[model samples]
Target: MIQIVPIDTPTLGDRSYLVGDGTVAFVVDPQRDIDRVLDLAARHGLRITDVFETHIHNDYVTGGLALARATGAAYHVNAADPVSFDRTPIRDHDVVEVGERMRVRAVATPGHTFTHLSYVLETPDRAPVVFTGGSLLFGSTGRPDLLGPSHTDELVRAQYASAHRLTGGLPDDTEICPTHGFGSFCSATQSEAERSTIGREKQVNPVLTQDEESYVEQLLAGLDAFPAYYAHMGPANTAGPAAVDLAEPRTADPAELRARIDAGEWVVDLRSRTAFAAGHLAGSLNFGLDGSFATYLGWLIPWGTPVSLLGDTPEQVAEAQRELVRIGIDRIESSATGEPEAWSGAAPLGTFPRASFTDLAAVRHHRAVTVLDVRRDSEWAGKHVDGAVHVPLHDLLHRLDEVPRGEVWVHCKSGYRASIGASVLAAAGHRVVVIDDQFDQAENAGLPMTA
Candidate 1:
């Protein structure tokens, strides 16, 4: 029996796969935490003999090198990828055999990156399955602009050709497994479908349906700002990241926590938006554990800043640590888990108010207030509250000077980012109210919206 298991890191919006043929398996695009892959392999009674990288990822630190070292599996990387560590230099059309019936063929499909590859898995009885990684995502293709504008024009054209090449070479029934596009910014556009095949994708995917010119134009038009910390991911992966250290960070006492915050080091509170709004360390920022914590935190913080985590439980701190490492933010200065009072010491906890769009609208009638929209540029461009200053959550910290002086009302598509923005403003001494409601509710609340 053949089993293909997807180990999803929903927090990072990526998936790694473990595929086996009863006795042996191969892993594709594993994350920084390799224990999950080890445990999955053990449960399936499979000895992994090979690990493949479709590309040197730009979004997360890869576990492929560590897993290969631990299991003594052949690490297959593109011969063209300039890396520090030694790997099995695989080229286009190089077929690698697994235990018995399984075989994987590497196809050069450069677009997402110049050295990108897609692996086609073949067996005697079953139809073919292709791991496209960041190349061809469901209903979308990987964004080609990560390398910068100089390479974008060339990469985008190559991306169009690569998509066609895969469809031409593989049968329509071939199953598609990709490493990104489940809320990851790597995808050119988001899709609702959970699973798809070449045939299904051909019918609906913009890359396959539209002409290359049309597809490229639409894709370029839709592209928006990605996380700022993405600047560090490529170099970390190229150097081959060290094995992740998820050990509990040194505990921070109240004095130490206050000291770090006073010194301008990031002391993040990993609680819910509601809890954070009620009370938190005055200077501590809230990148709540409930939302896209790592993405937002990594995006906003100055790179190489000493970060201390404050969470409600040890598990929460550990979870945040795991997510941080995936994005290559490996060093955590310290951590604490308990009530805010314990971490506050003599300092009084700071508080902020959270209201819905209806509340915001009612307040607008009586007084002048600043409305801040912290959604992405694309989202703000699509629709947003009129006269609201737009500073995306990723750019909120650096762009705070642009936010007007008043009782500022903050909101995003949902409440999560609004809370983060509100907290930042609150910490900066701005009287802020978090609009903890959906953006869709704004129209119903009689707020003037730009279409």
Candidate 2:
């Protein structure tokens, strides 16, 4: 009997799979935390004998090499990639055997990355499952623009060829399990389905239906701005990222934390947005350690900056660090759990002013405050406040100077990003009023809407 266990990292919205044939298995696209895969293997009485990566990932570090080293398993990557470490270089139609009857056939499907591949896992009682790393996603394919503008056309064309290659050769009932497109920024688009099949894709995926030129144009046009941290991932992976050290980080007391911050270090507060708003270290930034913590932290903080973590509990601090290391932000100088004010023996920062959509509606015409919509350009284009200043959260710091000189009110699709923006503004000495409410409230409250 063959068993396939999925290990999903929800924070980054990617899935890694463990395929076993009773006694042995191989892992596909494992994340930095290898323990999860180990636990799955342990439960099933399967020893992981091999590991595979579809591509050098853009969003997080890969656990392939590290896992291989840990387990004495053969690690695989594309032969074309100039990787620094030792790995089995796989090519089109290459076959790998992990168990008595379980095998994986590598299919060269370069699109998302120049060195991408899709693997077909063959086992006892299933047709087959194709692990489409970033090349082929649910309905949409991975974005070709990740490599850079110069490489986009070349990659997009390759994406077109790769899509056909998978759909044409594979059986219609073949399971399509992709690693991207599940809310990760890596996908060009998203699909609602929990699982996909080759037949369903042939009937629905536009690349299979449209002309190459049309498909390329559509894919390119739909491309969204990715996080700034993405640039570091490709290089980090190619150079062979180190295995994550998942120890509960050494706890630091208040004085050590305060001294580190005083010497020009970053202190990230990973508390609830409400908790952060209530009280946090004066110079510390609130990333909330939720939904999009990894992306926003990597995007907003200067690269290579050593950071310390502060949270309400040890569990929260550990969770925040786990997410941070995935994006190559492992230069953690210290970590601690406590009230923000107690961390430094100084009073925590004051809570910024907040107002609801209805309250802000009455004051919309006031020349005293500017309503800043910090959503993406697409969101802003579809609808936003009539007289609001537009600046996407990712670009806010660089363009902060462009904001008008006055008190500012900030909001995103929800309260999450608004809290982040509000913190940044407050830290910068600008007066900020957080409109910590849902965007839908804006329309019902009779606020101005512009499309």
Q: Against the true structure, whose lDDT is highest?
A: 1
Report the alpha-carbon TM-score of model 1 versus the true structure: 0.99
Per-residue lDDT of 233-338 in model 2, one digit per residue for the tens? 9999999988887677777887787777677678888887888777777667788877689888898777987888888898998888889888888767788887
Clashing pairs in 1: none
Alpha-carbon RMSD of each model: 0.9, 1.6
Off by over 4 Å in 1: none
Q: Give the alpha-carbon lDDT of every model.
A: 0.92, 0.86
**Top-TM-score structure, candidate number:** 1
Candidate 1 lDDT score relative to the true structure:
0.92
